[model samples]
Target chain A: MIEEFFLRALIAGVGVAAVAGPLGCFVVWRRMAYFGATLAHGALLGIALGLLIDVDPVFGIAASSVLIALIVTGLQRQGAIGGDTLLGILAHAGLALGLVALAFMSVRIDLMAYLFGDVLAVTWSDILWIYLGGTAVLATLALIWNTLLAITLNEELARAEGIDTARIQLVFMLILAVVIAIAMKIVGVLLIVSLLIIPAAAARPFARTPEQMAALAAAAGALSAAAGLFASLQWDTPAGPSIVAAATAIFALSFTFSGTLGKRAA
Target chain B: MALDKRSAGTGLLVEAKGLTVRFGASSALDGVDLTVSSGEIVSLIGPNGAGKTTLVRAVAGLVEASAGTLWRQPDLRIGYVPQRLSIDRVMPLTVRRLLSLAGRSSGAEIVSALAEVDAAALLKHAIHDLSGGEFQRVMLARALLRKPHLLLLDEPLQGVDLGGQLALYDLIGRLRRRHAMGVLLVSHDLHIVMAATDRVVCLNHHVCCSGAPESVRHHPEYTALFGAEAARRLAVYTHAHDHAHDLAGNPVAAADTNHADNEPEHLS
Candidate 1:
């Protein structure tokens, strides 16, 4: 009953959302929303450079995000400057440099498509990349899940218990970078962090444990993807923003159930 | 390695000889030699800028030593209760979930660990909602879940009421006896600390004095560093030891060489 292009878009969007849900919880837990924003901004530069070099944009995005992650980690270790200020600076610079590079590129590219995402234009190859790359990301995340949770809870505590915290942190950043590389096609640069965090926040009101929160976040994100896709079709709206809007709506709606988890939070 | 007083079997869990840790140019811990053997409670006491926390971290292998030899028993399992471990509100966590972080712990094991800390009912309670004393009990439960050979507790009594501190210290004493574990306690409170400590190492960037709890109180370096008033207040929990106070005189002389400029600054 559905056209193939619409079906492809649904599959791709839902796939990205499922992966984003678990990783997004870490983003929220670690209070790294600005860090996520910084990585997405750096991802834009990756896309521009990829087109310039005539290589796969996924590779460029991964490289750029990972490089930004390393720089942030290094700066945190030095810890001489304010962390949020440094992140704000890097985020703006990455965005400005990316825009300048995109303006100078010779190839004809739709700036709006990369800025807000063009989910309807995704091809079979893009869907393939989403599933394959996302599988690798999720598996790696599972491998480091407990240690990552430990570090997120307390880095010093993890190190005290014989965990190699620095290596675990670098590995977590790499996973975040890979997620950015794949999910960039679905939510685009500007609203990518919303896709990563909103669903996790929505699930928090119901979850009583970390694993439950992660599983609930994935389900919430998937439901949001499906709902946002249909809403876009009905209203003839931009697909990416529609998905983010749907997620925000769910996040807002979840407050009604706040007492479920909130009553015990004090 | 030569500082290792005994093998792992005999429970010389961690030993440091002339260990020095530097942050840039300033020395946090200088020429520190400390050791903890089985069934021993060694309390590290110092002022605000003292490297007490740093020494605990170093023994737990968190910080790299710049100089001197630091050795731990091979395959040493450590249970470390950090000074500050406030679980963020954003995290949805129960006491049960917190203990499970120690890996492979079961429901029965979790319950028992909580029972060991006198907080058996907190197993299902949300960690964020726990009172300061309750949160500490839960953290101790988590650490106990590791079944560690060495327990490193950094300021375990912070934010706790004095009555609650005595209770907590009692719980720690029972756990140590039952598990035969070595305890490395870092604390700033003198009144309650001397009551619980078997040995006290007064530290201020270096080892000022170390001996039986009562003996170290009268040492010149200890009195000079913490102020004589602190030493007098610490005498509140006096207990007779086999060795007399003057037995610590030799280490006091050695320790004074590094901080000769620091005279006894009596409390005003």
Candidate 2:
């Protein structure tokens, strides 16, 4: 017999995985893994803000991640500093600020739970947020899939084709913020990007088409979540890192299996 | 196929007057006046860092004109082939998928556009596997798929071999005659320009000289700006090149008929 809490954790993790899979494909394609990490790191400040205001950390995370993403977008026009430098500054600064703010709070905060996810402790309400938020993300992703892919191929080309590339990129970043907001409970702050890029990357060699890659990536993510959950149950490991480990293992397997495919993703 | 856009009076596709673009304190382009009319072929040539590309980008609305006014036909459809399109090696894409980057294109349209560029067979091939010349042809097909009113080619002949360059230039002339498309081409190489090109605008931060291809090459400013060797390379290589060719880049037909009629009178 399955425990209700484990069932809930399984459902929530799987929901987040399904959504992150296709989105991760874009993350990998645009080589925005650092950007993904930067946003996830910013989610901690959001959790602290949520605690300060007596609001749900999920909503706080959504607000902070979106704010950080927009700020980065706007400041990218400032020329001198490279994008990675900007992202690194924002990422570490946000994480440290969250830690400092959390330290000042009166309520007993389980730092471990927020830093690395306490997936085994997931509640039914968290599952609700996961599915509902994941649905919206998947729908929005489908609508902008082609346009996003075009811009990812070449921003200048897409702009010349009359696409408002900046607007599309902004929209994409917002979508990513929502993903971070909902997936935070599943994989915590630091491992969110691991859940994103690894599964998508693992699915790369096997896919002949982009749509195929997205579907395969989603499949890979779901299995990693399930397998990771099982391993956590068996070994009493932390659920967030276990999920990421499972994802990495799958990537290793894919790399080994696809070695004969001749072409490798750079 | 020049389906009478000129008669419909699309007139000027782009008109830029005294355009200036600056990056930080340095200027990329300065005081450049240029225009492209419907059914016109204009070539932009200059030395490296001459802002040839900046002018093209400004006209294409890719860059903001910092100090001057630029005008374009309302709702202008532009087919732009950038100088370099380095496909990300990780992205999974095929030639057939490339043509629809602007928007959705039907299979027939895709096939036809690829055929026009002599790259129809590359439809199923992964873009990562393509050679440089093959990639250029596919990019051209992608540009054509837009059925643009104004076409922008930034150094389109860079990777093509000499024989293929002659053939591709021939194809560009045919496109102008058939579609009446306005072409704004940027060329770094002085090796060749299309026989049908109406204007050659020489640039070195400013409009050094501008006129018909023949007169521009002979202008005193043109000679002074570009020394003897540069001007000598600007000499037009006019030859009949309409014959069909196999994939090996060899002419399949020896029939050279009236294709030469399109060249300047001095060339014949």
Candidate 3:
């Protein structure tokens, strides 16, 4: 039973790493850390909608995250308010609304399972969705990788070269929504932001290029996921938090090592 | 891939029609009309708040023009090197990698672009380790690597040393002659503007003057836009000899002030 649990977690962890690698690179590159959180929080609303409508929660999550992404993009373009202020309002509102909606559900649901993922409870079907969603996200990201990196480096420069930033941004956000929705199962909504950030941040100091950054981040994410799963198994801790904790540990170690290297070079 | 369409037979790489830009209440650029013909290098100059950057950003489409349109030749590819190239140092990147990030380019192309700005040797160096001049050259190399039909540069000489500035100027000269690419440069270097640019556009929230650099200097509108004192200061900033110490015998505290003093005012 323990071996089976470990194997299941490993499959799910790979799915998360595959999506997080490239998406996380963008998160760090575009300085979209808060934006990543916004999308993650918005996933809760997706969950609530899914449960309320008797549909798959992942579908609901993708839809809700996409909607939130669109809202943020629209407000930013329209200059309704500054991005951070608007994000602050939306982030909390989404969380509050999700909680409120969850409370109104007629049947009691294990809300903690969604917030802090129960990786062990992931069925074979859930594993299929994870792989399918993760593959689609990675393929799409690879196709537009150069263009996306160019835009992230400098928006106007990209535009001048006939790279449609608006179109590219829409595609990027859509992919991010899908990734967030699917990965929410492995890491949970609350901690999904960590998977997107910590691995990427950890890989940043060592990367020579954007490609290297994404590759290293993916490796770091997968390693952390494995390490976290083993630690959680030994200690009987919750899966999602344990994964994030392990990722944080990796980040701490990388930060210290990279810092020392930087000082030595200086 | 659709060809970039521009106005027919204009020979101008970029044309701005009644371009106006505002930041809140005050107009940063007002009714500015300018043109940069193929192979022509146009330099924009003005006082501190004279809307030099505003005009350039408007042209680059970095900032939307409150009113007016900017058109470029259908095939014109613009490369914009912004004034502030400094990002968070924690952001790890290398010069060669940054250039390739623009688009896929051959190693030879990358080498040539770097060679143009004399940054070829530092290709593998991390961005954080690069000097101000070297950093700017990397940006230039990135821009050139794209083989743009038009290059829009904002304060390219801002942090560069005299040698770097001259080297970049030479590269710009080569680009203009070899590729017939139009160059739109915004600089406070008044001395080089007259010599470097085929055309000079004097701007102070409007088209103060636009013509040959020497001719623009003689225009009363140009003098009136800056007034006598400011015009003199701009003249001083432009001239190499005028970089002498200020009233207190200290070097003029300007963006171009070199690192010889090793002051804490590291521009980055």
lDDT of each prediction vs. the true structure? 0.81, 0.80, 0.76
> Ten-residue segment with the worst summed lDDT in candidate 2 chain A?
A257-266
> Global lDDT for candidate 1?
0.81
Per-model TM-score, in order, reads 0.87, 0.86, 0.83
Model 3 Cα lDDT, one tens digit per residue, B204-228: 5766546654433454554576455
Please tell me which model should have the higher lDDT, number 1 or number 3: 1
- For residues A127-211, could you state the per-residue lDDT of candidate 1 as single tens digits? 9989998899899999999888988999898877778887987887888888887777787899899988999999988888988
Grade the docking of candidate 3.
acceptable
Off by over 4 Å in 2: A260-266, B1-10, B214-268
Query: Would candidate 1 be rated incorrect, acceptable, medium or high by CAPRI criteria?
Result: medium
Q: Assess each model's interface with DockQ, reporting 2 decimals per model.
A: 0.72, 0.50, 0.43
Off by over 4 Å in 3: A78-80, A260-266, B1-10, B21-26, B61-71, B189-194, B210-268
lDDT by residue (A1-266, candidate 2, tens digit) is: 88888998899888899899999999999999999999899889989999999998878887888888878878988767899999999999999999999999999989988888888888888888788888998998999988999899888888877888878888888889988888888888989999899999999888767888899999999999999999999999888899999999999999888893555533
lDDT of 3 at A106: 98
Worst 10 residues of 3 chain A by lDDT: A257-266
Runs in model 1 deviating more than 4 A are: A259-266, B1-10, B194-196, B215-268
Instruction: Give the Å error, residue A98, model 1.
Output: 1.8
lDDT for residue A230 in candidate 2, whole number 0-100: 90
RMSD of each: 6.4, 9.8, 8.3
Greater TM-score among 2 and 3 belongs to 2
